[model samples]
Each structure stands twice: as C-alpha cells, then as structure tokens.
Target: MVVGSDGYPLPMARFFPNLAIALSRETFARIDAAETVTNLLSA
Candidate 1:
C-alpha cells in the first residue's frame, strides 16, 4: 500500500490509471531501446 503525505493510503490506480496505461509494453521497449543506445554511446 502506498501512503500519502497526510498518512493516508493512496489509491495509485485511481489517481494515475492513465499513467499506468501509458506505460505499455511498446512504450517500455522504446524506453529500453533509448537507454541501451545511450549506454552504448557513453561507453
């Protein structure tokens, strides 16, 4: 359970359902690809 600053349990799904949906498998793959490219460039 996630707690808020007020010491109350926060409903993450209720508050950020859209954010959860936005992080789909395709989005994760794109993010992973970007990170891998950055790491290779910096190495």
Candidate 2:
C-alpha cells in the first residue's frame, strides 16, 4: 500500500523510481519503433 505526502507513503512515483524507469524505457523503445506515433496517427 502506498501513502501520499503529509507523512504518507507515495503510491508509486516516490517508492518506485526503478519501475518508472523501466516503463519509460519501454515507452521510449515503442516510440523509437514508431508504434506510439502510428497509434497517434490512427487515432
């Protein structure tokens, strides 16, 4: 379970920088492959 500020645990952002980094890597990889851009165009 995650808490917020004011003496609370952050949901993910604070406690999961590595997860964020992994997600970012995947996102960038997809972007570099033009997957995201293609989806944007299809939308």
Highest TM-score scorer = 2
- Per-residue lDDT tens digits of candidate 1, residues 9-30? 9988978888888778679999
Q: Scored by Cα lDDT, where does model 2 land? A: 0.82
Supply the global lDDT for candidate 1. 0.89
Task: Give per-residue CA lDDT, model 2, range 1-43, as digits (tens).
Answer: 7866677666767788999999999999987879768878999
**Which residue runs does candidate 2 get wrong by more than 4 Å?**
1-7, 35-43
Which candidate number has the best lDDT? Answer: 1
- How far residue 3's Cα lies from its native spot in candidate 2, in Å, is 4.5
| lDDT, candidate 2, at 26 | 96
Q: Give the TM-score of candidate 1.
A: 0.47
